[model samples]
Target: MDVSLKNRFLKSYFSFSVGIWFSAIISFLSVPITSWLIEPAEYGKATMFSTIYSMILLIVLIGTPNGFMRLYHSVEEKRKLLWSSLVVPVFLSVIFFGFVLLFKDTVNIFLAGQKNSKAHLILVFAVFFGVLQTFSQTVLRMQEKGFSYSALQIVSAASNVLFVILYALLISRNFYAVLYAQLFSNILALSLGIYLHRESWFPIKIDKSLVKEILAYSYPFLLSGVVWWLFGWTDRIVLRMYSTFEEIGLYSAAFKLVSVMSLFTSGFSTFWYPFAYEQYEKNPNNKELFSKTFDYISFLILILALLIMSAKNVIFLLFAKSYRSSAYIAPFLLLQPVAITMAIVVARGIDFAKKTYWYIISDGVAAAFNIIGNLLLIPLLGAKGAAVTTGLSSIIVFAIEKAASEKLYPVKYNSKRAYVSMLILIIIASINTFFERFYVGILSSLTGIVVVTLLYNDVFRKLMKSFFEFLNRLKSMNK
Candidate 1:
């Protein structure tokens, strides 16, 4: 890529990353406080509610967000495209809401894993608001309104923390605190999102043919979405069967810690999606740019993984004594976000070719592996088993998607380096999880970092060169 393109990429990435990183920092700060306020069992119950909410959101949205994003630039009638993308999902969500109300008893038992009518109703409304909020943010992302998008993210995260604290202290100190905080936070964020993007989506225009076309492209992902959800959440669901809510809570805590890695993944995806589609539209065979971007991202993600592993013990000290055991489970869960983020670049070819169904094959196989692994391993190893299963399943998904993407749109990525780095990551994670020696983790992580840096020395050299060039430009402009 040229210097100008590199500058644009960095500018856009940091714009998104600033908000995401702030949001992550706030969430990280709140984790210790929240874990103190709510017990492990309560946290586990809240996790269940979130899991159900995600399933409903997936079903009602029917992959419309992806469709809207994919077609945004291609379609001239932007407002109509927005309306068409949202109308069906809104209709489906309403129907699903009514169905949930009608079968409240069964849903309360099966979905929330508890019999609470108020919580069930709260969850139903959450899904409704979630759909609107999701699309509103998507609009901000597609328009490249990075500041507005970042503001929305910051507000959402901050508000959630405040609400959780207030609800826990003033109202109740149980799972309801978590659930109500999310519901209200969504309302606040959604309201702000609509206000921010009002001009773009106002005077909603619905086109029947446009709706059909968008759905035609997006509906396949509905199946893929289900399997993808399974791929991501099956470990937690299966763990619920073999373990106690306390174990689930510990596992969830570890997952939350590992989710900090999402700062990179979320920021990258938010910027990369629209950016990638726009670039591909301009030049279909821009393989070098894509390959180099992948290498840089992979290096960064691996380095972050090693650092997190090295600091696992120190980070876990923030949590309460009951939750500290989560340190053991935190290392491998890093793979989930790392793999998902890397796949954003490596798997763009699938979206570029519009082969949405390939998602099913990749996610389905990984989800299947997760289910079996959790079933067999959770019985013997409990939460650690689920963690191990998740790490391995993530790798499976990444490998399959990378290969498929190569066949469709061949990018000459340095696979040997990626694979070797991943191998080193697994070894370091294993040592950290199984052994209590702090020095052992530090030594392994340092060694892994050195080896990875050596493997990507070219990326480092190019980045250094770019930095000096950027500095020279600044100096000349000043003179």
Candidate 2:
């Protein structure tokens, strides 16, 4: 990498990292606070409400945000592209809203189950704002406005904490309070997001040709998004069907704790797509660059997985007593993010090539397997089964995506290094989950550090070299 480009990348990276870390902390604090305030069953139901909005957002947007990001590279009129993406999705959302009203009774029964239909209705509005929130964030990212993007995230996270605290303490301490806080926070962020990207909203032109192009690029992505949702959320849904709300609560709590991995994945991911796509565009056949990037990402994820599993006890302490089973579930659930990180590394091929149908294939296969796995496993093993199934399903999806992507853009990743790191992680995680001893956790942490270091010594050396060089350059420039 050129020194100037590398420096700029690092600057953006640190900006994003700091912002995301702050956001993660707010989220981390909020989880326990929310868990503490509500009953386990209520918390579970609240989580389900969040999932309901996620499903609705997936349908309403139809992957247009993704196409918007990718197509921004080629589109001449950025505002027009934004208009097309927003207009079509908003139109679809309106139609979907009508359908919701028409089938209010049936939809309420299906989604709300024994809960109140009124909350689900509020979530419909939340879904609309949430879609806008996502679309606006994508525009910020595509424009490479990392600082603004991070600021928006900080505001969202802070507002979420504030609103949830207010509702829980002053107003109500029920699941509805949690949902309402989230809904209001999203609205706040959506409004701010629109203001930030206000340029994209105006002179609204419904460009039929642009909409057609965006849909063409995003069509496969739509299916992939649904399948990805299933891959991610089906476990909870199936578990809800087979188990009690307490179990769902436990699983959800554990999942939230393990999202420590997502802090890293998402923070880097915020910077990665734009960076990776730019790198690919600059030199399409730079196979080694992609390969080395994948290796580094894989190593980082493994290290994070190890640390989180080792510190499960510390994480569990933050939760209420009723949610403590989340500690044991955390180790297995941590693997899900590792798999996701790996998938992100390899999925770039399909993304860059615009062969997003491969994403559908990979996500679909794993989602189907996960649903079946959950049905079988949740009946026998309960939450643990769901966690294990989620991990394995993600791993399978990563493998399939990597295999498919390599055929299209043959990045020569160090497969042995990645595979071995993953295998060691699996062994260490299994030990931590099953053995459940402080010594085992300690030993596994040490082993993970040593093994990963030995496996990626070259990468580490280069990373250190780059760091020192960067520091020296900074000092010289100051002088």
Candidate 3:
């Protein structure tokens, strides 16, 4: 890459990454505060509500955002393209809402109490705004306006936090309040997003050919999303079914803590498709580039896992004493993102080859494993069982996806180094889980850190060298 292009990528990466990092911090802060304010059972119920909402949102979206991003750069009538993307999701969402109405009693069973009718209605709005926010943010990204995209993201996150705090203070801190906060925050963000991109909403003509193309690209994501959602949330749903809400609450809290890993993964996710597609378009022969990129990203995520796992105790201290037991699963849960990152990096192979059916198959198998694993384990072991099984399922999915992707579109990834790092992580995590001694956990963490550093010394040096070189340039410019 040329210096200018490399610098632009780095700048855009950090610009957007800082927004995700800030959002993660805000989200992390909300958990302990919300947990403290609400009853454990209520917190669990609210979390259950959010989980269901996420699943529905995924279904309603039908992976259109990914389709939109993929097609955005190529299409001439971006406005029509954007509006066309919205039509199917909006139509599907309405149909889903109708079904929710038809099955009012069934939906309320999960929600239980506190204005059940109102909560369901607000949930529909949340899903609507959620889809809108996703498209608007993606549009900004498609335009390469990283700073604006980051601004809106930070605003949405900040507004959510602020709303939660206000709701807890002004109203009740129960599930109702949580739902109300979510509804208002989504509305606020969506309104701002629409205002920012109001011009694009015009000339709303449906291009049949473009719509077909987007659907062709998005269909696999639609299928894979459903399977992926099941894989991600079956543990919680099963816990709700077989176990108690309190256990669910504890598990949910651990998930919130582990979500900090998204601060890193989220940034990469935003950059990856656009970056990957751009690189492939420029040079399809850049196999080594993709492979090295995967190794480097996997290692970075491992570093994040190491940092979070090592500080698991300190991090959990922010939770209520009743909720602190949630910390035990943090080590396992922290690795979830690592597994996800590996799959995402390697999946580039399948994406370039346009064989998204592999994703559907991979995720379907993994979701089944997760469901079966949760069933067998939750009854026997509780939250810890859920954690162990979930981690194992994630790794299974990654392995399957990587194997399939490599076979289809070979990328000469540094498999040995990557596998070694993963092995070390698994061992150290197991040690920490079993021993629970402060020194043992710390020692295991140090060992993992050492292994990662040894494997990634070159990447580390290059990063540091870039930092110093940038600083030197800044100094010269100021002088």
Candidate 4:
């Protein structure tokens, strides 16, 4: 049973991991051509608009998807629950978009919103597409069709490259052009998702009781979403608020670099809830399952951290002449994956407990910490301040969530190994932090990761077995 489960996870993990890398690759491919077509300022505006759009999405969805994940496994009431949970977000989305269409000017000055008054209508359409797109994709993720889901995502992503290249190179640089492309991508994704995972959505009906339960679960993120996004996005918006577009450009580049960590965590974390829920189903009372999940995930994060620290300089230097600032922040950014992985861990426990309120409260606290940190730090430190605040906030959040998870579940999180692993990471971070040089520290970090990875002989043996099995699976497919 364990072997089969582990194998499945490895396959799922690998697929999602490759999907992330592919998405990154496609984005890079589109970049030079797109940049040649549109000025940085225009591209920056589009990026900023999307960020605001995502923030607005929080209100429209009002915690539905997050709530859905938290409560779906517990929903005995079922169908009405699904319908009930979805209705509010959909209705609210329409209403909110309508308001934005109406009050275009007020949105910018008062709402901390975007300045693109002319593109407000297209923005609404894009946001609506985004909500529907998320709803459809969430259904597939819940169904555990990892390979099919990833393929659907890849198709949309690849299409994005085509459209971006076409629009940027051959068409207008109007923000709506980008918006139209995004809307099309979402439409394609929704279509592909519905086509591939037709089973879960069908015969779908409302469950009032289940809906209430899920809403209750999601209520936390709904609240947390607002504050969480504000803090998450505050640095960028604040830069626009306080500084010039040119300064915003530098900050945007740095922010884009850090978002890589989020991408890395997204797939793993997306699968995490379902994975945990499944384990709990199989062994409802097995503390070992939770402990093992945490350890395995922690170990994985450690490996990634080591790799990022090692490769930060070479990667940024290789990517673009303008993106040199990434090296300055990548090490600090690398530390973020640890906190992020732990946040997901906490979120998993919170999700399973059906205590959605805790999720909101915890996020609120973390958001508060970030906001205060940014306000105090950004004025003094600038772009680096933003990075520092983000990294520290992640750690603070992880610590808080870990405490909360411990309280609710009362399991050993295998912290002794975690502590040792973190100590090694800290040494690497400190070396870089002190010298503020990439090469020597990077080499040291790379060497340390190798030496430490070797320490777990049992782990290495298991990894080799898994690798061979994966290779064999590929070999059989070729036959």
Which candidate has the highest lDDT of all?
Answer: 1
Q: Which candidate is the best by TM-score?
A: 1
What would the per-residue lDDT of candidate 1 be over residues 179-295, giving only the tens digit for each residue? 998999899999988886788879989999989888988987899889887677788788888899899989988987777788788899999998888888879888888998999
Q: List the candidates ranked by TM-score, beginning with the highest.
A: 1, 3, 2, 4
Task: Estimate TM-scores for all models.
Answer: 0.90, 0.89, 0.89, 0.87
Q: Residue 97 in candidate 4 has what lDDT?
A: 77
- Please, what are the lDDT tens digits per residue for candidate 2 over residues 216-333? 8888888988888767778878888999988888988888767778888887888778777767877888777677778777877887788777778777887778887677777778
**Tens digits of lDDT, candidate 3, 203-318:** 67788888888888888998998888767778988898889989988888888777888777888778777777777776888777677678668878999899788888788887
Better model by lDDT, 2 or 3? 2
Model 2 misplaced stretches (Cα beyond 4 Å): 32-45, 105-121, 165-176, 237-249, 318-325, 375-381, 467-479
Which parts of model 1 are misplaced by more than 4 Å? 32-46, 105-116, 165-177, 240-249, 321-325, 467-479
Q: Where does candidate 4 stray beyond 4 Å?
A: 76-81, 105-118, 168-171, 237-263, 319-325, 375-381, 447-461, 464-479
Q: Residue 317's C-alpha lDDT in candidate 3?
A: 89
* TM-score, cand. 1: 0.90
Off by over 4 Å in 3: 32-45, 101-116, 164-174, 237-250, 320-326, 375-381, 474-479
Could you tell me which 10 consecutive residues in candidate 3 have the lowest summed lDDT? Answer: 110-119
Clashes of each: 0, 0, 0, 8
| CA error at residue 474 for candidate 2, angstroms | 7.6
